[model samples]
Target chain A: MKRRTEVVLAGLGGQGLILIGKILGEAAAIYEGKNSVQTQSYGVASRGGFSKSEVVISSEEIAYPEVLDPDVVLTLSQQAYDLYKNKVRKDCWLIYDSDTITGEGVSDKEFGFPITTVAVELRNTRILNMIALGILVKLTGIVSVESILRSLEKNIPSQFRDVNLRAFQRGLEMS
Target chain B: MHDRIKFLQGNEACVEGALTAGASFYAGYPITPSSEIAELASIRLPAVGGVFIQMEDEIASMAALVGASMAGAKAFTATSGPGFSLMQENIGLAIMTEAPCVIINVQRSGPSTGLATKPAQADVMQARWGTHGDHAIIVLSPASVQECYELMIQAFNFAEEFRTPVIFLSDEIVGHMREKVILRDDIPIVNRKFPKVDPPEYRPYQPGEDGVPPLAYFGSDYIFHASSSMHDETGYPNNVPDNAEKVIKRLYKKIYDHRDEIIITKEYETEDAEIILVSFGASARSAREAVYILRESGYKAGLLQLNTLWPFPDEKVRQLADRAKFMVVPEMNLGQIISEVKRVVEARIPVYGVNKVNGEIITPYEILGKIKEVF
Candidate 1:
């Protein structure tokens, strides 16, 4: 059987779900030379609108552009968890923010990570997305840390490249 | 070709293909099904020393593209049904002024906002006649992600070569579907031919025997006033009936005189088949697959995939219509292109339509059912 993993990153707008999706998709498709597809959906309301970026990476050919079900579901908001908690397979891993997600007994397989707390503790609240990215990198090992850093260096602006690298490293360091 | 084949959505392939085709300017508004084109363009264009502008609306997006193309940049914009409707006035302007630019209509279900993120091929006729009144257009519909990349380059080539706006008529299926796309880095790219004539004797509307007017760059000290009104060969205002008639006639003549060069269609098993399936864009993809299934089941089914949609490939369609006893038209819309097929076929054969507007693809099975029904 082909090792295929479908990941769904759900959050409110401005949480950099799209960026994380792009980075991971590019890392798999461009670096690992695997087949990957990333798609995103957002609402009309900015900032607070429910946004989600779904990605599927596989060693074999992938079809059905949208992820019908995901192997891993990561959420940053209660709305996201509520929207997607039921859809994820029972055996799949669930990652949620303990800082924001309040719904309990949803999934005993869930791992609560205080991503916002980690970002604030790192003295840069803007790195919440990077911290999440770091967690994603460590959890899956779908892509090498070097490849993620290289993609980040190429993707982020020159002014804040070092800070984002630090944030990525910090996320990699956490658990 | 680099030996790397990657799976990509049709929208992303279009972006990469545009970059490969030397497109340096893209202006578009955010709309679903077509938003990926804009997003990819925004991220990729800047890296290639190109410019991407998110205009306030489709109108400005169309205008800015025209302006950018006039400045000698290979420009393009992507829109869907409503946005395509808003772009009609400017499309007509491009028709009149003969500006070379590409417009990608990643069509979705609509008369007006019917389904914002759904798929439809309802814009086929609109692409040809949407701009209004006696104009020539070259529209290419891509059936796969590979074609999305290949046809975009062709769209630009046709636009620049003929000095008219070329429309890449895509739909939400090919616009959003993910498939393997092999991008070529060394595809033959063409740029607009700038006039080498002296500025003093230049006529913006001057046409050779071939009906193509030489393109003059704006702000080049050439003071020709390009207008949507009737003009003389010297690009000056003219109200004379003959002058207007001559200008309009030449505009049509440029495309009509070269329809043999402009028209493109793929003939699959049409040489000796009683039943012919005529479709374009996404429907053609399903039709091709359906035809293969029919062939496997011991039925003689052929497919005519229309790559060039405008000037409407009447000859090829008529030829197929004359020989085939049954014709099936599969589209994402109800009876759009089938009407044209019916017109040219002149009821010589039984015409059937496999139509869908429910925001889902009319599957190969549906088309196969229609083929069986007609057979």
Candidate 2:
């Protein structure tokens, strides 16, 4: 197993990219029995501007929280897909929202899931992030699916916990 | 002794370290990436019968800490970026007054609020020359969460030992990252020696052979004054030529005498490398990986990581310069530590730069590509 795993999640603000990174990092550290450091970079503008969170999980201690080049890149926007596609290594797996980012450059071999479309069908746009999270867990297997679900249970606010859990389950099934 | 290795952010570790070092007072404004330090101190300090005050700004934060230190209590404050800039005026005053206090500057991207919550090590030069004049300051840059815990105690110790303000220069990444930090019970700690004599004989600026003047507490039996301006031996402001010389010389000598005990650095795989990447903070992490990757691909590369930024560790750097053919510096800033590297290299070696200012960590691939290009 690789000692270090770097994952970058990029999308517009309010897409829950940072939350997803946080969930994944916490799951790795708290559940998977590893060490992880999650750091984020968000823009000034809300909604449409780029927001990225880089999570580095390792069996050993992590010195630097910033990810240089990610081994895994998850894109939820056209801009994010374009931004990360140019930098991610060929061997690096890319998980993207098939509905927003069209067929073309990196997504040819990439895992494409229409997360937003799934959320729309479920009549909840907010859970698109959980959909993305499920796909990420299934794809990478960095943490057990059960652990991620438990992590979501602990992390999500009490007010919207039920919907988020359903969204996570739907995501896990879709992947 | 084996139980306290709990998961903690760098800021929390700093609080723990300060507590271990017997810090009784903390005063600071809340700033992102570093707010946790102040928050932790607030919760932890009062529990230990210590005082934690949230000041209006960083200037007041520094002032309060210095005042608390002079009141015969260990003191500290933590801030990032613009707040650090705000604290510079008092930082110089702390130096002038020979105040023994610790200031933790958890660095974020800046000049001013460049990125409120992101990580960057752009404050290297600011930690060194943020103040106006030529005064020696001990600044320790910790790269890991564990080091953040350990260096905070060292920051307090160094500040007390030399009766100078010490800056625990750290970055947002290290400051915010959570890791397992061992909080040991029996860690060695030091406190500044205070005056034990009759109050009338005490002069706050009177130097002993080691260049450290015995400190006096406010509200104690000792009646003395401290000035930011040049002061005579008796703690009175004087424009006399000899008095000015004595003050400056004593100030410099206090830190200069302790330089040997102050300097620290970490060298990685330099025995057979041709090009050495000199870096600190997060950049050093990437540089170490870059060296590993380059070596795996059959290239001779190494890294020289500096944990103690100021007093710049010129001798260790000079030794590295003697061995490596080319030196490369990668920083989130435009150029800060690069100039320091150049100074020690003295143009004897070809020094290259892989600079980034778009608020991103310089990666191993980016650094390795540069190493390849330069080599």
Candidate 3:
């Protein structure tokens, strides 16, 4: 298993990119007892603006908070995909929402899922981030499923917990 | 033990530290990259029977802090660039009146609201000399979320111990970044000393052996005046040349006399290092990584992370300069602290600055590239 992993979740503002990044960081830092740092950047607009959250999880202390080179890049919009697609290294895992992005010039490490469609089928489009998170855990095993579940219980409100958990479970199954 | 570990943004951690330090009053106008401090304070202060007020502007907010601190409350305010600019006048008031308070400047890019949400370290000089007149101030900067929590307690402690306004100089990147913070139950808390004299005999500005006058809170039995003018020992205006010099010199003396206690710094891998990277706030994190990469690449690079920015840590920098052949200072500003490093090194070693002002953090690789170019 990798001792350190850098993950970037990029999408339009209001897509819950930052929240998922927080969940991932909490899982590693709080639940799994590893070190982690989560830093985010977004455009001025409240919604539909460029948003990116980077999480670095490590067994040791993390020196730089921002992601220099990502081990995994997850894009939820075509704009996000376009921005980060060429920036990732050749061996990096590139995950995207197939429902919204076209997977042109695919690589073996690239994976696309109908993340929005799956969330809609789960009866809430808001859970797309959780589905993407599920795919990330299944692919990289950076953080355990149990750790993420415990982290969700702490981060998500009681009213939204059930839907989010179901979305995450479905995500684990899809990949 | 697991329950004590939590993930928190640097801004949130600062609020927790302030509350833990017994800060019972907060008044500020919310500003970007720093609103979390106010938001959390609003929720937490009232619950702890503390006071939280959203003043009309930064000027009023700073006034409220000084007023509250004088009234015996450990008070603080959080703001960004423009708001910090507005508070400069009252910061001087806090200084002149000898009211201990913490002013949190979670700095953003700015000449004037330059990039409202972006991080910058351009306020180093401003934190030192923004207010008019020559004055000594305590300015502490933190590079991580955990330090945000820990240093905030130190900020409040120094404010009370020195009886002056202490600036908690944080930048947007450090303020917004989330990381694990251990909520230690054993952190020490410091409170200002109170007057032991009778009400009639009490003189508010009369110094004890330590040069710090025991503060008398408002509504206390001590009926002494506290004014912003050049006051004598009784806290009444005495603008005589000798009296003014005495009053101002005491203010500087109270801080500088105990300079060793007020300044804190951290050295990483500098025992035999020839190349030293000096930095603070978020940029220090990058410098730390740059040191690691350089060491792995067979270069003797180390880091000197300044936890306290003001009073400039001249002696420590000078000591490090004796052993170092080259020094590099990395900052989010074009070049603020690098000048301080240069002044201390005094051309004993070649000093270089890797400055960034594009609202992006100075990455470790960028610092490494600069080291390679100069090495």
Candidate 4:
């Protein structure tokens, strides 16, 4: 029923959030036969600064690429949540990582899970965003799990592909 | 895997378009927002048996591109605000020497190095006038990632066909934005029209009936001269008034006389519309969305998106103004193209500018708000 939805993923640098945004957008655009635009903005530092990526998906052409007001948001850090929490629709589905970010004064219309904790338990903490991505897929069903799997295979290197795939599957199961 | 659809960034698509257009040389310096073009070119150019050189700076990069083009290669370079300003002099050189090449400006905000990572559509006028002197330039403004690929092919085609420097002016939002692009090999590709005259009979700068000089490459069988000063048919710098006058007239006429063929503008929902929104590049994206919003609300609003930035799309805009009540120009800068629109409309109709310049894109709501006020 959703014709258009904007999703924002915010985190500190080196959180692999940009990679997650790319995979989600590619899956929707390339496999789901939908229009998608991925726009990211980050601080000047290569790492250790605030960074975020926003993807807007629509059944028709996406006119404006940036997230005007998010339908869904996944904030992995306190600073990021504080900055973007006010920039979403009142009816937005807020998803946060409880292990990495505190839920103090967070919204009532929200969900929380330890996405990073799940990834760490799986023995590769870098796949935290993949877990977040999986939960997002379960919530919105923006793109198929098969599309995400294909994107993961194309984007991830052979050396670490198995772990990333496992992380995606585990995140899906958790959701 | 045959009909591969790609979620390609606009910058990456621009590079691919150049490669597909037979661009064999790339000389560039890395800058934010536009650096991906250079990075991808460096990686892909070599695999395709082309040359990719990271020049010392923008000046050298542009100079190298000019050198490569004169040596008979489809050459290009990409830059942002600061680098675009730096390459202006060499662009003028290329213009004067009639070297066919493409220079891409992935626009960001700035009089200097302003918001290198952010998007701005301020370079609309700079692409046409950045180079010194009165010269005719072809500038193409692409709105989407697919146009980023398709228009680059057009850019290369116009460069070779007209024997002039073509500017591919794309903004930061479109440059960094990623969208699904079809990478099919069915698009038409054009190479430069080479002269068939004998070595002793060839005149490198001589204009045919179309006023475009058939390019003769360096180290070719024919001896040729290329210079920045006003040159005659012999390609030697000429300061005489008659020779200079003829050459200048030919240069302007080559593009201006063919303006009808060179200028390109796309009209959206113009039928039975009262007010029209005129915009180009990334700002046009929002203008289009605003028009959609207005029409859905039963308002008679339309959009005129300029895909060809240079030559100002004068006659076409005038034709659109004939049917519309007024015009609204929204851009990232204060108001560059609005003045041109007014000039073409001759102020018989109202042409207003909705300006924004905070290193951000103009949103649909902003443009729709302005449109509501006008209504």
Docking class of 3: high
Better of 1 and 2 by TM-score: 2
Off by over 4 Å in 1: A1-175, B1-4
Q: Could you tell me the C-alpha RMSD of candidate 1 in Å?
A: 5.9
> Lowest lDDT 10-mer window, candidate 3 chain B?
B1-10
Task: List iRMS (one decimal) for every candidate.
Answer: 5.0, 2.8, 0.7, 1.0
TM-score of 2: 0.87
User: What are the lDDT scores of the predictions, listed in order?
Assistant: 0.82, 0.84, 0.92, 0.87
For this target, which candidate reaches the highest TM-score against the unseen true structure? Answer: 3
The TM-score between candidate 1 and the true structure equals: 0.73
lDDT of predicted model 2: 0.84
Give per-residue CA lDDT, model 1, range B62-141, as digits (tens). Answer: 99888887777889999899999999999888878888899999998888988786688999889989988988888999
> What TM-scores does chain A show, candidate by candidate in order?
0.91, 0.93, 0.95, 0.92
- Computed on C-alpha atoms, the DockQ of candidate 2 is 0.33
lDDT: worst 10-residue window of model 1 chain A:
A60-69
Docking quality level of the chain pair in candidate 1? incorrect
Residue-level lDDT tens digits of model 3 in A14-74: 8899999999999999999999999999877888878999999998988988888889999
> Which 10-residue window of candidate 3 chain A scores lowest in summed lDDT?
A103-112
**Candidate 3 segments exceeding 4 Å error:** A1-3, B1-3
Interface RMSD of structure candidate 2 (Å): 2.8
lDDT of 3 by residue, B255-359 (tens): 888879888999999999999999999999999989988988899889999999988899999999999999999999889898989988888889999999999
TM-score of each: 0.73, 0.87, 0.98, 0.96
* Model 4, span B1-375: residue lDDT tens: 243479999999999899889999999999988999999999999999999999999999989988999999999999999999999999999888888899999998888877767888888778888887888999999999999998999899999988899999998889988999987677778888788889898888988888988988888897988888888888987899999888888887898888877788888898888889999888998898888888888989999899998988888788889988889999999999998999899978888889999877888999887867876
Query: Who wins the lDDT comparison?
Result: 3
| Candidate achieving higher TM-score, 2 or 4 | 4
